[model samples]
Target: MDVNLQFWSTEGKSFFQRFLHWADILDPTVLLNSNKKIEKSRLLLQTNAQTLQEPLQDKKVKEAWKLSLSSVHPGTGEIIPLVFRPPAFLPLATPLLFASLLPHRGAKQAIIWQAFPYFVMTQHKLSGPMQTFFKRILPIPLLACLSVFNVMIVRGTEYENGIEVMDKNGKVIGVSQKAGLKAVQETALSRAALFGTAVIIPESLLYFLYRTNFLLRNPHALTPLRLVMTVSALGAMLPVSFSVFPQLGEIKRDDLEKEILSSTEETELFYNRGV
Candidate 1:
């Protein structure tokens, strides 16, 4: 049976959803940072628990508040460098207490709120390297294999069942239904010559784009997009290779599983730790 593959639409999703999805992935750190900051503030509150000293003026508080959390966080494997400074909010009223004030720059609010509950309520637990590498990298490679497909030319006059042919008028040409019983050798080659020839350009272009974004902002978006492109390249190439020699398409999940399972414990604990 012939199966058709579809891909993620170029059509975009709402910005908030994308932002939140990234937040979902990144929330552990954000939450950790936020809660740590709140705790710092609360301690400051408890110690200097006096009423606000003449409404909070832009007058600089202590140089800056810094907290360095040294434990490994989950999911992304990152160390949380939790830092907090008093919010730079435009104070409307005189500062009675620092706790009474709010930050002027509220852009971090959603990030803070999303992470706060998680920080307060939960402990992050994530997979070790063997599990992680397989869970993360395996799907990406598989995904890449699925995303791009290719057609190929075969040497023999008798066509294979899965092969597709096109005529000059954009009509699909069918191979002869007749099959010979004698075993025949097949030599398969790529249908899209240009794709095979210039694969490096696309791969390099994606890398350049990713690096440029990394240099500029290094935001969450750049990382995933880079992953998408990287996987896209792999995906694009795998099928093309398969089309050229269909036997190359065969991937043994059993072998892959064994390899991943074997290395479960010796993997670096910190590599599995989130930064």
Candidate 2:
């Protein structure tokens, strides 16, 4: 089996095992590795996979797996763009988060909404749904919506290209659009959940922290503190969201569309759920 395929196969692990697996892959340091190193890691895994289940364990092999998996697309075997890669997400979002956290912007929103009643039965100042959306917990869901939209725009071609289904022997059997859409949908939801948690938790934590005397006593700590929280949330959630759905999704032969069904006699097959 392809190492990537093996990683996501049903035999791989339970949720906790998958969580630990992704935690290694999602390490941001993978972004620092050179092209040469990534190829070497791929080679190591390939050479050792048949002989060793753990694959010649050592720091080099381990780090190599991390860099290769995180940097390269499992489906296409291409280097994912820096910004779009999971490890790079925190680095890209952290600074903008800090800027958004400036007191003036939040103060403006709080001031405008402060006077509005929590529950306005009159429905004149603002409609009930509108008020709840803007003032309540819906901001996270809205961000999730945008996450789905972005995924569609950025990687829509994967849906069109269809997934290459493979037999247990690792031979390509056929392409299936059903498998492809499932992968994309799961990825979209995972991304939404990831960013939603990342954004909401830090702000909520800092909102309370802002009132504490510690921040007042040392305003300089705010920058590092914000960085810590954002990175921590991503560290915790990336594994979860990635593991929420299997990266290699399965389709029973009976469930596939008529066109895809005729290509293989096997009762079950697998497709790469691109990261």
Candidate 3:
């Protein structure tokens, strides 16, 4: 039994290493940096060959390094910077904007409505189990509502100007009157459903695991283990959520305005249904 356990552990480690290597290949930043490294190496080799007879001076070597760093690849003709900024806050921007647009009473009511669930969950008087239960369940509904609101705000903004209609060749023909609103409604419903599914599945699994004492078995490792479990759950759910709906939304040409249909020969059209 001990030998079997050791073999399984070794296999698990190998599996994780392979998974990380595959993830690295799929990572955009890593791929970009790798290409940059290859380009820099080639440039250094060419520079070294040219200066082989008379070794480069210290200043010239420094200059060459700087030039290699700054030089863009001939293929892409663009230099990727070393620093990267993640757009983590982009998802929150829409919700904040939606809240800002409401009247004073409406905004106050919205804030209170959203905050009430959190307040109840965090109340000091509540028992630990009750608090944990609320914490797990409340986020599902709250997130679903917020997702719907975000979709409304986005679609409302697009409705003001209308969405661009394109021809079969991908050329913009004209704007459709209510096509944007319809697309937004469909996307919003789909997203809300997906959000609920994604949140509920993980929360349910975690709740069960917690009840079984699977997560609390190792007191010293609890925090890191929970974090890893959470990340793994999200990673597993993302692909399933994305697969739930078709990203390219289809609309009948007849649903569009007369002018738009006349401009395009196709009876059906497709547009990116925003996530």
Candidate 4:
């Protein structure tokens, strides 16, 4: 009994030590310090600073460092710490934090649209594998449609008064309803493409993982691994998806209504192609 107690105590100490090591590695402060060091070194080289303190004294360098340490509003130039920036930090920390916790009607609709079809499909008497296959395939198109719908709803309403028709000198001319609608449509198509890729690629990889019984082999780690895979797939595709569409939507003067073209100074018009 004494020998057994000693063995258990030794194992407990080992487990505690491993946990501490991992905790240190995962700590945000550790990551922050490492980032700060690398950035400071870069700044020093760029500015030809004799010391770190010299670089920090520059007003622009100070602002840039602050921006690097946190999130900033591109339009307003408002700087907020990572913890304060709900959009960036919340999604990284909690997968469904904004979906469930926030008062976003669009997010709620997206969840329902993605979920309701699966619930209905499950009611029918289908084989387990068949049900799984249908569950994966059906949501892809639904999500794509939802993405388009969301884009139209958000951008359509925002530009309901018509987008500002700018001249070559960036002066605001008369608004153009047709131009606004065209911009919204372009954004909607782009969103549909992004959603389709994000859903299809991850689901395809997940299907293969299941077929190989990867989850079964590591049953305890299944949920975490699946979450990691989904997040990673979306993260990898997000930049590529965004780059697929130009943010500055363009339209020819001929495409606009006769009145709008005659009123505007420029031969061509541009509007914001929202994400």
Q: Per model, how many backbone clashes are there? A: 15, 0, 0, 0
Order of the predicted models by lDDT, top scorer first: 2, 4, 3, 1
Provide the overall lDDT of each model, using Cα atoms, as 2-decimal numbers. Answer: 0.27, 0.70, 0.49, 0.51
By TM-score, the candidates rank as 2, 4, 3, 1
TM-score of each: 0.19, 0.77, 0.52, 0.60
Better of 2 and 3 by TM-score: 2
Which model is ahead, 1 or 2, in terms of lDDT?
2
lDDT of 2 at 144: 66
The candidate, 1 or 4, that scores higher on TM-score is: 4
Which residue pairs in candidate 3 have backbone atoms (N, alpha carbon, C) closer than 3 angstroms, thus clashing? none
Model 1 stretches astray by more than 4 angstroms: 1-126, 144-217, 220-275
Better of 1 and 4 by lDDT: 4
Taking the tens digit of each residue's C-alpha lDDT, what string does model 1 give over 54-90? 2123222221111211222221223333331111111
Q: Candidate 3 residues 88-207, lDDT tens each?
A: 112333244234222233223545434555566446556677765554566567777777887788668666777766554445667765767776777677667755665566456656
* Model 1, C-alpha of 174: deviation from truth (Å): 10
Instruction: Compose the digit string of candidate 4's lDDT tens values, residues 1-275.
Output: 11111112222234343233222222344224344553553343345433233424676554443333233322233444445442253245336522321122332354654456545654675667777654556767876787788778877764576775554444555677887888778767766776577556656776688889986787776566556655665555444444454444557877777778777657776554434
Return the lDDT, model 1, position 20.
29
lDDT (0-100) at residue 115 of candidate 3?
A: 55
TM accuracy, model 4: 0.60
C-alpha displacement of 260 in model 1, angstroms? Answer: 48
